[model samples]
Target: MKFLPVGYNTQDLEKQAKNKWRWQWLSECDSKGMKWTDWLKKIDVCGVAYCTFCGKTINYKSNGKKALKLHCEDGNHQKIANVVKTNSVSSILAI
Candidate 1:
């Protein structure tokens, strides 16, 4: 039982291409036009959001439960996280 960290490099770059479908999953989300709140929970899709102190992946659950705090691994998300919490992500200005 092993779970790879959000980002790992031990895998050979070429053969590991098997998992390169992340972008395609994201593209699928784009094509569906689902709400960000809904799409964020679709599983198999992860993301990276950064600010001064946060360099970690987001944590979300089904039915819109969220605790996207910036922890030791996901630290400085105060500002950006606030923006998302306050409104639909689509309403935000491009950053």
Candidate 2:
């Protein structure tokens, strides 16, 4: 009897590829109500939206903005936000 090689499933590979594509598409297209603030930026990885500043990830399918807001409200994110705001103000004053 001859058997196929172990761990060689074409269907699984195809499914993974399809899912990756779908996630990429969703990340590119799904950005409603997401503000482009210095404290956070939308980054999609494997179908999840993440805050670049705070390193927080959220499901794009479930209220990504809310998660971002929460992160921004956190103490660490707040500190970064304050620093960014201060720098902007300083630059504007220098100009």
Candidate 3:
């Protein structure tokens, strides 16, 4: 027996198209109405995003912006965001 991957299914491929990642997502505000552009960036890979704050990679594949939203709400991400904010402020003040 053989199993087909989601990419091989026509309907799944169509769904992937509908859920494709958009560069605009990085500029859009999160559910909390906070912009994450300073930490979020597009990966060269077809449907992947990178979070510089936590050094995390997010694969949107068929989930699109929902994946990004979840990443923003993740506890670890929030923790890292605070750390980044503190570090930047201290570094600036040191100058």
Candidate 4:
């Protein structure tokens, strides 16, 4: 996610373009029965949203739901999600 230096109109245009793409991606997700707001609400606790599996802080404004979906599909994220799930169950059993 590189950007031009500040004070350049081109930077603003680039940002707008990226936003459009993100919005389009979100729309596609919605059509597929994936609600961006629902996903965001699940992960966006305490005003900060991050990937539970990968610990990557989300930039919702810039990347929107695409980032969340990507993280969910990532192999590392899946592995970590599984590990976290296992750990939680183990802790409950220990208790």
Clashes of 2: 0
Stretches off by above 4 angstroms in model 1 are: 1-14, 30-54, 57-95
lDDT of each: 0.31, 0.42, 0.66, 0.44
Candidate 1 structure quality by residue, lDDT tens digits, 1-95 = 13333344423432323233122222322222332332222223332322222333443322112232213222233444454556756666654
Off by over 4 Å in 3: 1-18, 31-33, 93-95
Clashes of each: 2, 0, 0, 0
After TM-score superposition, the amount by which residue 58's alpha carbon in candidate 3 deviates from its true location, in angstroms, is 0.1
Clash-forming residue pairs, model 2: none
Clashing pairs in 1: 53-76, 54-76
Better of 1 and 3 by TM-score: 3
Please provide, for model 2 over 1-95, each residue's C-alpha lDDT reduced to its tens digit, 9 standing for 90 to 100.
Answer: 12223233334333423222122222231133323343333332333445555666544334434444455566776665556556877868889
TM-score of 2: 0.41
Which candidate number has the best lDDT? 3
Instruction: List, residue by residue over 1-93, the lDDT tens digit for candidate 4.
Output: 332222323333335333322223323333334334323322212112444346465554456555667656667756655565568778688
TM-score of each: 0.22, 0.41, 0.68, 0.42
lDDT of 2 at 21: 19
Clash tally for model 4: 0
Worst 10 residues of 2 by lDDT: 21-30
Model 3 poorest 10 in a row by lDDT: 1-10
Ranking by TM-score: 3, 4, 2, 1
Which is the better candidate, 1 or 4, if ranked by lDDT? 4
